[model samples]
Target chain A: MEPGSEREVLTLALGIAIAVVSVVKRHVFRGLPRARRLGIAGASMLVAWTATVLEHLVFFEVLDTVEHLAYFGAALALTSWIVSVPRGFAEPRGPG
Target chain B: MNEALQIAASLVLLVGLVLTPRARTLSVPARVAVAVLFGALFVQQVLDVLERHRVAWADPVGDAIAGAVPFLWGGLLLLMVDRFHTRRLSAQRAQTDSLIDELPAAVAVLDAGARVVRTSAGWRQLFPSAPLDVPLSESVGPLPEALAAALRRTLADELRGAGDAERVPGEDRWWSWVVSSWQDADASGAIVMIQDVTSRVHRETDRESTQRLAIVGELAAGVAHDMNNLLTVLQLHVESMRRRSGSANEASLRSMEEAVQLASEMTHGVLRLAKPGEDEGRAQVALASLVGDTVRLVRSTLLRKYELVLTSTGRPATLDGSATRLQQMLLNLIVNARDAMPEGGRIDVSVVATEDEAQIRVSDRGPGIAPELLPRIFTPFFTTKGAAGTGLGLSVVRGVAEEHGGRIEVSSEPGEGTTFTITLPVGSHARVPQRRAS
Candidate 1:
């Protein structure tokens, strides 16, 4: 009902959606290099969502810090993955 | 420290964005989504910094951008994953196409409507005019009608799989085809494979002819043995009769002996045909004498309605070859000429000696071969005569000529006549000139 509460809900929904998509299309990531970093990024985003939901019950300051840390972790992993993309990714790897 | 970590993460994200190879690999929309994703994360980092510094209006902006960040990540992940799948599929399709193209057998894939989807290199070689996306029957090539009809039937589900070897009309070639229906998730069609089996068919025919010849040789040997015994008995009786009835029966006895001698010579010719090994060894053969002998043998067996004429240039035309095989070759040409004229016509057999070769010609005043059919006349198992012909005559003549280091040529006028000329290299043996004979 609050002005910012809706944004939290939407973020939580998107995190869940991303998790479901990753699980369903898990085969897509099998051969990719540094794919674990991408998974870590997704896990960090999920953790941030959980911390946002638990902020009212737990130590508010601590939970807020935890959420920001999780977001930072997700951003760091995502950036690492982006920078690590191989030059040959554009070229096809299979026989023609 | 948390705000410091956030600023570090944002800076790393910005650096990654600038250096990521995905900028060149990803599609336009995907690249934009990636940029937006990094921007949102950077904005969140900026909001964290501002809140840490007690700036106003940071909370609301942080909430809104935070909400958008996850969606952007989701969109970017989906886009990159989709791009990977597209590349993999494209690679697999390319591999399949190359595999098909490299296959030795002519192969084609058709849609449910029987239109060609793809073809192999062999298919292109076989049907150079056949183009992609065209109905096979409409393609300009020697695709047999039977194969096209079978393909249609197969695609229509009226036939499961069809295969046959068909001789191309007007061509001495034979093609074999196999068609089968294939069903995939998105489509159903037929795969057609074709092969040129002309040589295979010829080899099988030659094998069968060899088998038949072996059987005929055995039979001829037995008949020749019996005929020789009968001629020997007749010769003894003629000699006995001449001694009993002195001068008065001399002429009759001599005629009886001459008939017996002719019968003996005929039996010898049959024996020679039976035991090919006896004449397989090449020797100096006088073409004129061989032609005369063959004409005599043919005259004795031929119908009286046909006129047989033999001529020579009086100059000896000697060749190093199998005498019996040469005789058989001449016999086949003469018989072929005789068959051409059912109403009986003049067959001229001639031997002419040149400086380096001997030319033997058999001319017939019967209907000649068509011009279009000339090239195929020497092809094994090709025949112009309906059911009554064996189609092996000219091919045998050609084989024997080539075997003797010679060549055979034919010229024909459809209504007028046909002449078969066989030229053999002259042997190094001494040439013995003789008087002109007819």
Candidate 2:
């Protein structure tokens, strides 16, 4: 097989394997926040896609690195907010 | 197309969620089915990855196969669930059957079809000839006709909507029945449970009659007391008249005097039944002293040839009861023991004390109480001695014991003889003075 087709096949194979694993681990991974998980998976996918595009395309811009970093920073802030938020914020029991 | 498949798959999952077994309220079978379904779905996804080439995340056919595994798992899960539940049900049913069999009261169950489902040994013994239930109307013939009719109507009402009913079919027997509905896989039926309450009812009736008789006895004693005083006055006047009237006949005077004696004895019997000095409160009594006094009082009369043995250990057993009452109780017990050994046997009267209570035992070597008569010995006016025995001796003994917050018990075998045991509580010596005041 040509290298291009071989790469396509390999990526597809990897995606299917990950999908199976994701389904099986869904019950175990239930403890994590859904939005945070989605954000992480999305960020990883974008990073891998960007690196692949960059290897072929030599275009560069000063704003690109800043934008990427900003996006990652925003993601980290959102995750911290979710994790630190107390569940139900129960009233402390004591004398009135 | 892929988005469309994703939407369909999402809908399928939504449907499954709508039907998911609720954790708090789901049955064992439903819970197992849910778990199996979720597991099977995960397995199907693994299979799809192993078989397929590049596939979109939302390919309906691929995801459909994965989703359908849950339904398939439901079928397999239910079979195993059935086996588990069946074993559990069988165990519960076995426990219920054994409990019914071992019940002391007669119990019977009839199905909605009016067939006898089961009957306890007690039930069989109660009505051996009860025809296999064609219906309640046909089977229970020994029951009073009016009672049977009332019972049938009550049962019909219960069958219409679950309820309970009770009836007294005869003077000696009581019956209660309840109806309830039961559902199985393909059939629904009603259960009828019948229980006999004869012994309990009889006990309650006897207690009521005894109370009524006690009231009557008190009234009779009151009337007899007044008459005795008047008769004594009449006899005194009559004797004075006989001496003052020098010409009065001797035979008439003798007859009148004999009549007066008979009336006096009758009046004494009434006074005894009334328990003349019972109004006096309980006093602390020494067990050894009481026994000695009782033996001495009865030593004057020797109606029986029996050897009397009176013995006690000096345990200082004291009771909170009137001395006269206690003496009377002991006298009655001694007389009973003496009478039992008419031909010539031994009588042992002993006082024993333990940590919590004190006991006085009067045992006789006479023909022991018949097994059937032992239970009824304390009933007022129940006597084996026809006219010779008033049957009030043991009953009065029990009454005295109870008035003192004590109890009397009798144990016997046919050939061995009988033991009458009286148990009284042991109070501290300090309370003796206070008890005397009360």
Candidate 3:
């Protein structure tokens, strides 16, 4: 296969694997704050995008870093606050 | 800077959407509209990011956050559904608790492990010592083995559905218990209900006993009447024979007299037993002769395996009771002793007259009563001998004893044997009679 084609396939495969794992471990993620988990997912995605950005991997800027952090932070914070519930564990005596 | 401003705008919009008033109370269409509005804002934030930032920041960091907004909305919807479920479950639990608390019967909910979870007010009142989360077996006092076994079976069943009514044995009370399965989508357990059924059971038992006693009384009265007629005929024949012999056969005449007297006593005894409560005929009863006569009658009819022994320490162990009734009581005891030792065992009938009481003890070597069953031995219609027993023998003996201001006591051990003692006030009846040479 071609080098670019292989990289695309690899990226696609990695994304699919991570997505599958995230679905399975949804409970673990639910325990985490939604904002924090979003931040992690966004950071991971950034790393992956940066890998594709070999040509664009020149340097970092303050405006760029803050801007990137803002969107991820708000999304995750909204998600976490919205969801957070638990199920059960217990009993009763005789019928009345 | 443009990306940052867009992110800030998205934050403000997300907060505004979440804090929206009456989201839950809104119509489905309104909820949909609100969700759509939030979606549009999220899309707008991503679009602004793409417009301002390079693909490096936009696709990865910016768009990923924007994409997670829909998921956050999904999570919020799940939270709302979860709250509804919790509210419904709590309402059901409260209703069940209220229903059970107001019930007349004591009810308990047992978990999978047979541990008590929730209990009704009646249950708490009835068995105050039992507390929640304790195993039922541990909380309950010692129950009849059969009942305990049944309760265990109920707990094991997936849909426990069983009920039983049983006497408390030593006590006069009776209780009916029912076990049923209690389960919902979330929880599963056994619901046990206990009702005091003393009055109901007693009413049923009394009806049966009264019916049987009436039948028995009818039969006994007929027999007694026939015996009286026969005795009168015999008396006439003896008188004729006596007149013809002219006092020559004195011994034979005396023997006939004794036989006639014994028959008369038997007739009277039958009549007394036939009557429900006839306490008029009271006299100084010659307990020894009564016992001796009963023994003779029993020996003639008894199985060959039984060896009957009669011991009379004080010959005229009389009591201020009807001689016929005393004889009936003695005969009944002897008969019971004979019945007990079916495999040919020793039966001792002892009449020991003390200063205050005439104590007659009838003991037998046989398979004795069970300790658990011992307390119920005197209960009417409660018998181990299913079809063959009327379960009235002991009850009758107790009644007769109590009628004469006396009591019957029994001591027994399984496989060892049983002994029953009847104590009647000797009083003035202990006087020795003038004896004639035989």
Candidate 4:
């Protein structure tokens, strides 16, 4: 098989496996800590995205790999903010 | 394709190994075994990656890689199957161990070879320090021949799938046996689960006894009610007779009145047995103060020989219940603690808080309730204190707790001392407390 085709196949399989894993996590990790679950999910998505970026850089070499990496880095930052931002930030201080 | 198959097979093996069970909590050896399996799979992945990229491989490196690939693949396959088998065996052992551990009855298992395979933890209560895998007869040596025969027959019938055999009850212990046949890849075996069943069967018997006591309590209440009514009528009639007779028979009238009063007192005793005092209402009662008060109330019973210590987190914890009922509950616990230490030891009352509940634990440094009796301690009217105890104390405490949306549990070993825990909802009435007034 062509290296490019095999790489594409591997990437696809990894994506499918990750999607299945995320669904399994939703079903199985019901009792687990929410923060831990989010961490695992975020890490898995980042890893899958990194793999995709590496595959494209190796084969197509169209866009810079660093740009894709930076995009995932931003995604991670967004995930952190989404998880940690307090709902009651605008509430008044104590005793007032 | 071959490389992909190897990878797929490796993935399957890795998944299987990760899921194996250790008999105890996850052990070091088991974790190491899992890590080694992962390492082998990783090496295989690296080899496939190297070959795919056309990396310059030295002759030795190529041969080594090729040799290691199949070896690692084969090793992982064997290891996965091995781990699966081990996990199955461990599970069976765990099931057997927990069966013996938790069940208050003595249990023993016999294999197809009629060898003793598993025995319940309760076995030691009867035959202490007995060796495992010895012949059933040798272990049952202390028992009578007839009892031994019955036990063996039960074990045999269990192996044959003739349903579990029920052995004749022992003079000293209660015995029940369940046998099952199993065929593993390794060997065919019979698993005999021997249970002392003494406590369970005894609890059943105690239940019957409690039923009888309840009947008796009902009868006593009926008789007392009737007698109280008669005495009330008699006392009135005697007073009238004395009034009419005046000086003619004052002493006889006095005697009649005294007899009526005595009968009235007797009726009170009967009533105490038939219907324990009932209270209604929910109030926040501090546990520390309650324990202190109970200690004071039972001060004479302690007789300076035993110390009643009220240990608390001092958080001013409160439970919603009738203070009177709380006092009665504490009094029963204190009295029980005092009685437990006839030779005398310290009784510690610990009040602790859980996330959503308040826990009051009464622990005694006395000969704890025997393990056999631990489960039955909460059953109504089942007391080791014989005729002296009404056996209604714990039952009453439990009833009061349940009424307040709480529960009472006891944990004890023969020598390790007993802890009676009363857990009540943290705040009063997230909903209404169920209470009945008399």
Model number with the top lDDT: 1
Task: Point to the candidate with the largest TM-score.
Answer: 1
Error of 4 at B338 (Å): 1.7
Residue-by-residue lDDT tens digits, candidate 4, B1-438: 434543554454344344433212223453454345344434544554465578766323533433333333233323433443455466666665776666656666656565666666666675687777877666665443444554455445633332232344345365555445655566555554455555666667678888888898899899899989988899889988988899799887787787788678668656754665532456777666776776665775567788887767735666666666666677778778878888888888878765467788888877888776776677777788988987878888887777678889888877777788887776543234565442
Q: Which stretches of candidate 1 lie over 4 Å from their true place?
A: A1-6, A28-34, A53-57, A60-62, A90-96, B17-22, B140-177, B220-264, B277-328, B334-357, B361-386, B390-438
Q: In candidate 2, which residue pairs get closer than 3 Å at backbone N, Cα or C atoms, i.e. clash? A: none
Give one digit per residue, the lDDT tens place, for model 1 in B1-438: 667677777787777667554556666777788778878888878886897788879988988898888888788787877777777667767878889889878999888988889889888998887888877766635567787778778988747555556887667678888898887558899988888898788678767866776787689889999989988988998888888888898887887888899778668867865554454356778788888988998998899889999989947877766787778799899999999899998999989987688889999999888898898789765677855665767987887787677789999999999999998877563333221121
Task: Provide DockQ values for all models, in the order shown.
Answer: 0.52, 0.02, 0.03, 0.01
**If scored against the real structure, what TM-score would every candidate get?**
0.74, 0.39, 0.53, 0.41
Tell me the tens digit of each residue's lDDT in model 3 across B118-220.
Answer: 8888888888888678788677655545556666776666545444567665676677777777667766777777777776886688678778878987898
Ranking by DockQ: 1, 3, 2, 4
**What's candidate 3's DockQ score?**
0.03
| lDDT accuracy of residue B27 in candidate 1 | 68
Worst 10 residues of 3 chain B by lDDT: B429-438
i-RMSD per candidate, Å: 2.5, 18.1, 11.7, 17.5
- Error (Å) of candidate 3 at residue B280 is 5.3
Docking class of 4: incorrect
Model 1: residue B266 alpha-carbon error in angstroms? 3.8
Scanning candidate 4 chain B in windows of ten residues, the lowest lDDT window is B19-28
Clash statistics: count for each candidate: 0, 0, 13, 8
Please say which candidate is ahead in lDDT: 3 or 4: 3
RMSD of each: 6.2, 14.9, 13.0, 21.7
